[model samples]
Target: MGTRLQNKVAIITGSTSGIGRGCAELFAEEGAHVIVNDDGSRKGLGEEVVEHIKASGGSASFFRADVFQSEDLRKLIEYATETYGRLDILMNNAYKGHATSVLEQEEADWDMVFNSSVKAAFLGCKYALPAMIKAGAGSIINTASIHGLLGGLRHSAYASAKAAIVNLTRQMAVDYGKYGIRVNSICPGRIVTEGKIEFLKKYPEEVRRQQAVYPLRRPGTMREAASAALFLASEDASFVTGHALVVDGGLTAQLPDSVAEPLEEGLGLFRTE
Candidate 1:
């Protein structure tokens, strides 16, 4: 019921859950006719998302497709333009990665992670760009991660794929700026998605450690990340492109030991109270 994206058409992959789901709902609420894409395994969840959108007075439909496959991605783009008459935004938010170091990771695991996290974005842009070129204007948002900007303890494959996406966004922006297509990436920090919630339940101590590092003293939410994507997708960011907007609660802006507690009592560098 917002006019921010009134009459626009958007396709968001991996939109059945997590941050992608947040983008799907928020984009639809902002007046875009959304194409909610997810893999066939999550068809029921995808349909549920569409039903929720409709019930809330928004326009949306579910399209089940494996984003890693070029053929499937091609159909996804076609389905959007054919259904909505034009494509205005494309969000390549699908992601899958293993928690393994470079030396410990299997070849198959590396391939799968790259195909899911990096290749999917490449294909989404590849197929969506032509339709956007015809429309004379478009927005493409890629879901990179804070891990892409900084190193992670045991996330070699995920970090590398996200870094690739960040650069890919820049490359696409440079290549297609003349066509009026804007490309950008969102680098989110630790967000409290369902999976993350479960992980935190198992390791409550980890939660405290993570919160201490973030300047906000807490993890972010999917809605917060979605808002960042919305800004990049809307005309508010018309002049923005090739930017990796960091949404990490200022975690990367501080020094590694800035959040450390004082060794002696009443000697903290920065008082929390």
Candidate 2:
């Protein structure tokens, strides 16, 4: 195993599957004792993740915490500290909400999005800060999206929440750098998570169109996004904080009209599935 994060304790929220799972597993491989978490919505998935890590000779355990619940968020931070005696990394990577325009969305949709995306990261920082402050160092990785930088149609709630997270990360970095705590965010564009892989399989044309816009000519992988989180969490980024790291495979670097050239026709027509 790599020693990039040797002896560190990492709490990754909503880590049962997708990019969260990728971060959890990769963190473990890098010698961090990972606290794999889920909101209990995935039932046995968290344990399954733990088993996989253990089989690979990495240290890991399962913890269930719904980021939407403040108490649950508090306890998650507590669990990591009580079990490991120190908190070195807090990866706020869970997001749940409706995918629609604000004009056509429900009030609860906005609430859920902000609560899951923005508020959860806030609470994670709230509860984890003390232990980090006590220990004199920590790293927090908030998973944002390219939508946070360039708003996407039909992703109003999710996009807005992500935008909030990006700024929140910046604000926290300014507030916490005095204690050696690094706050950074990763903004991935079209990461092909499990769900997206299925979608890509079904909508090959859409995949092609999405790739055509990206200089890399493909959607990113969960591992690619996880690597960004790993970099932020490790000493490799010791002097980096309050930065939104984009892992969008060169999609966001393009001009606005260039990006819209191929996607304009399909805007608001793509389904979440």
Candidate 3:
């Protein structure tokens, strides 16, 4: 195993599946003691992830907790410190949202999206900060999205929450730098998570059309996203903080004309899915 994160203790929220799962595995492979956190709904999957890490000769443990609950988040951080004796990293990667424009979205939808995406990050930071301060240094990685940098239809709550997270990363960085804690975020575009893979299988033509717009001409994988998190958590990024590293395969760097004209007819194809 790599020693990039050797002897570090990392708490990754919502790490049972998708990008969170990828981060858990990669952090373990890098010799970090991983605390894989997920909600009770995915207890079995969380256990499976822990087992997978162990089989690969990595250290990992699963903790079921709801990110939206302040008490749960507090306990999650406590669990990491009590079990590992130090908290070196915290990746607030949990998110949940549905596709709906502001005008069409219900109050309940807004609450759910904000609580899961924005408020949960807030709570994670709130509880993890003291432990990190005690450790003398720490890395905090928030998983924002390209949607946070750019607007999209039918993603009002999700986009707004992500945008808030990006700024929150910056604000936290400024506040915690004195304490040796680095705060940053990752803005991913079209990552190939398990759910996205399923969607692509059902819409092969749409995939080709979407790929045509990106400079890389394809979607990114969860491993790629995990690598970015790994970088931010490692000493390689010692000088980096309060930065939203865009891992979008150059999607955000392109001019609107490249995709806008074609997207006029294919706008429906571009979604948070």
Q: Report clashes for each candidate as comma-separated counts.
A: 0, 0, 0
Candidate 1 C-alpha lDDT tens digits along 18-80: 999999999999999999988879548888999999999999999989977899999999998
Q: Point out where model 3 deviates above 4 Å.
A: 260-273
Better of 1 and 3 by lDDT: 3
On a 0 to 1 TM-score scale, where does candidate 3 land against the true structure? 0.94
1 against 2, candidate with superior lDDT: 2
> What 10-residue stretch in candidate 2 is worst by lDDT?
264-273
Tell me the deviation in Å of residue 55 in model 2: 0.8
Model 3 weakest lDDT span, ten residues long: 264-273
TM-score (all chains, Cα) for each model? 0.94, 0.94, 0.94
Task: Report the lDDT tens digits of candidate 2 across residue range 1-273.
Answer: 899999999999989889999999999999999999988876788999999999998999998999999999999999988898999999999888886987899999889989998999999999999999999999999999889988787988888888999999999999999999999999998888888888878877877676667777677898999999999999999999999999988987888798776577564344334
lDDT of 3 by residue, 176-232 (tens): 999999999999998889888888889777686776677776789999999999999
Q: Model 3 Cα displacement at 43 (Å)?
A: 3.9
